[model samples]
Target: MDALKEGWFSEINDLWPGIAVSLEVTKVLHREKSQFQDILVIDTKAHGKALVLDGIIQCTEHDEFSYQEMISFLPLCSHPNPKNVLIVGGGDGGVAREVVKHPDVEKVIQVEIDPAVMEVARTHLPFMAASLDDPKLTVNIGDGFEFMKKHRGEFDVIITDSSDPVGPAECLFQESYFALMKAALKPNGIICSQAGTAWANLDHVTKTLNHCRTVYPVTAYGIAAVPTYPTGQIGFVLGSLDPTTNFREPIKIFTEEELDKMKMKYYNDKIHRGAFTLPRFVEKALTSSHEIPQESRKEL
Candidate 1:
């Protein structure tokens, strides 16, 4: 790919044009073109092992916990009893790792579109992939959208840990996808999906939240600091079937000792409440009556 040059791997994409994030590559562990996308695993100089998909940085070993933990717990903790959880995408297994750690979560079913991404993560990024072996998690290799269509009103919580809305993951960001997730959830179920960076893709983020609003009565957006991601930040779109659901306050509060036991690095009760608090600009953009251009809207 054109992203690698002079021992540095740069992430340059049309989604965030004119800007890129580069990491120094110490060694190339594995690189190949999978049926779904280009999968690359490399040993970085400082950030540790990283997984790259279709020339975009999926996660680096350094700060992946921030995104993984927030995405997993923000919704899991919001629900009173999230016993059964369904994970859509997240081929790297990071989301699975965190999802299985929840005390209330008993069973996890992960549906990933690309098995090649999971294989590369298992071979090169075991820190995140090792959790895929958890007995509580049943891994399925298939299309998440089709999988959700077959199962209805089953899962208590469904987390969509997808990449940017492009390539194989494009369908996961649509309003239809949110509707499907709504159909696949049990009563009082909550769903969270990866929303793009507001700093770089505010309009796209607003569009995603708007799509969720059409499906679920309660919808909110939250963010976490992921240095490797675009703009050093990433956001998540959360929706709950219950109107009383508060995305800002988690129902299950973890004690410090419990957090330590779970090895949580970035997520806690305080951080959970703060994640939904957006900057003034983002709040205005999401709440204001400003109409998005026709071209900016995603075709349903």
Candidate 2:
């Protein structure tokens, strides 16, 4: 089995049974049990340095840009004027790096439950942690839930860069957390979260969408290809406070020159629109406002 292979480190995702992704570990760079979860850093044979939290790969040096750019830019671009942004649980600093790239963004406040995640990223994964030092960004080491509670209706865009829904991150995927996100946003504010792997966790996607519908009238789903994540694809759930907001269309489309300046890798206006066009099975499972009959369900 891959788990027992020599010089290999593997993460077995319980949600996805009978599969484990392994990497050729050159060395164990760092390991610690933080206040919240187990944080690990390793030098890999293929993906360069990797950040693992609670034995799950969160991001790798090679493909980190895909996740950081998509999650940060999707909601920011969809909002009319996202001058203020809030990031919950992205202690690694990749999301903060992308958020500060927008010239229109005046401020970004990140709340991380565990400071060790950021410290490990800084010491080992410096590339991903570089933006933690941006002047416009503030790193708050506290519970995101309490932070949002105190600062209500203050943010234009909120991004939840949480880990999967288990252990320390389990509460982040619950309905109460969605309600907290709604309260933290302005009237026209937009929010996006790393939902899960739709192909493997369709039930999780459906539950998140149902909770979002109860709060935000405008809710949409998007997916990105991240090989390190389970099923080689991950999904996002977006919700907008504005009733008429079209999550498919980004209000602020960056020029190619601007994208180059921002050092963006995977997020573009066209990709933003295309991400919402889900597979038939996924669409049927997460169709927010409609119910398909049994006969039609099989056809799809």
Residue 47 of model 2, lDDT score: 93
Q: Using lDDT as the measure, which candidate wins?
A: 1
Compose the digit string of candidate 2's lDDT tens values, residues 15-48.
7777788889998999889878988889999999
Against the true structure, candidate 1 reaches a TM-score of 0.95
lDDT of 1 by residue, 1-300 (tens): 335578899999999988889999888999999999998888899899988898899999999999999999999999999999999999899999999999989999999989998888888889999999999999999999899999999999999999888998998999999999999999989999999999999889999988887777678889899988889999999999887898888899989999999999999999999998889999988876225444433211
C-alpha-based local distance difference test score of model 1: 0.90
RMSD of each: 3.9, 3.7
List pairs with backbone clashes in candidate 2: none
